[model samples]
Target: MPIRYALPNDADAMAEITCAAFAEFEDFDVTREQSAANWRRNLLAEAAERPRPHHTRIAELPDGTVIGLVKGGPADPGLGLDAEILALAIHPDHQRHGHGRALLRTVAADLCADGFGSLAIRVLAVNERARRFYTSLGGVLAGEVPPGEVFYAWPELAALL
Candidate 1:
């Protein structure tokens, strides 16, 4: 699958990708409202209205089936702070193919060029596979990330020489 920035109309497919990825993992049971709000906030909104949600990407096969998705946004309200990968989901059939890393690198590279200095991502803490993936890419843990199993990420190398 070729990974690229996701378009707004891809919301439904993105949601499917999300459900598939989250279902197979042992992590927080994301609420339906939470998921619905995500598609609205991220996929439906335009860049001018919501910058973070606009920073989304998708991976699709030649047939145009979306197999993976990634979304990132501001670290918090009013800090000009940047964060990463609010969510990333790839179809199980497409896992372990460096698709996730490529999607992440694409977003981080954009943030770097935009002078973000640092980028953060959050992963379910109990999801060791997810955590290891982020750590391998150089993400550092913060706080406890709540719900007993969550971790935030910082993928960029700090302080460029």
Candidate 2:
């Protein structure tokens, strides 16, 4: 998997993939319409800044088609986390491969090198698949966030690196 910083042109495809990935989560008020709208807002907001609001990476195949994306950056003020992975979505057609893991490894490596000791990821409480995937990558259930969301933390970043 080739992972690289996302470019401006990738927003549409990224939004599509993101919406598709999240639309299956039944525990939210999110609708397909809301997801697309949110993606647009997020991409625009990030692009308007000098540096991106989040550190986002795109995973592409050999021929340059994006198959997955991962976004991480400084944790939210109240999270008490050193760093956070905001999103990780692999296209349905590309899921079950190692792309998601590869993206996570890339983010973890960078955050660790930057001296972050812990990394947090939030998953829907009912999203067992996502919870399992994070656990497989060494994420431990730390606590609950907002309604229907739980926080998973890599307390020992070294264990992941």
Candidate 3:
């Protein structure tokens, strides 16, 4: 699995992967259309930010088809995070294939290089699969966020790598 920074041209594929991965999360409150729009906007905004948009990564197959994505960066104040995994998604067809784990490792390494001390992620308590996935990657339950989401953190990136 080759991982690369997502260019503007990759927005549609990224949106598709994200929407499909998140389709079951009705609690997220954003419609597919809204999510797509936000992805597009955020991609451009990330590019404009300093440090060059390393936060969004796209996973691709040998033939150049995108199959997964991970998005995050140094914490956003609105989200109350110092560093966070804003979103991670693998196409339904690509799940359980190590793409998710690779994404987490890649992102954690990036965050570490960027000088972040820890990385945070929020998962719905009801989403057992997600919780398991994060924990499997060494994510520690840091606390709980409102609306029934649990916050998990990986305080050290070396272990993740």
Using TM-score as the measure, the top candidate is: 3
Residue 41's lDDT within candidate 2 is: 81
lDDT of 1 at 56: 72
lDDT of 1 at 136: 78
For candidate 3, what is the TM-score?
A: 0.86
User: Could you give me the TM-score of model 1 versus the true structure?
Assistant: 0.78
The backbone clash count of each candidate, in order, is: 3, 0, 0
Q: Which portions of model 3 miss their true places by more than 4 Å?
A: 1-8, 76-81
lDDT for position 135 in model 1: 73
lDDT of 1 at 13: 71
lDDT of each: 0.65, 0.77, 0.78
lDDT, candidate 3, 1-161, per-residue tens: 55453433567777788888877878766666777788889888887888753587778886778888888677655545468888889999999989888887887777778877767888888889999988888888888788789888876656778
lDDT of 2: 0.77
- Candidate 2 residue lDDT tens string, 1-161: 55454442466667767777877776545555666677678777777866444666778766777778887778876777789999889988888887788788877776677677778898889988889998998788989998879999887776776
Residue 32 CA displacement from its true place in model 1, Å: 7.2
Candidates sorted on TM-score, descending: 3, 2, 1
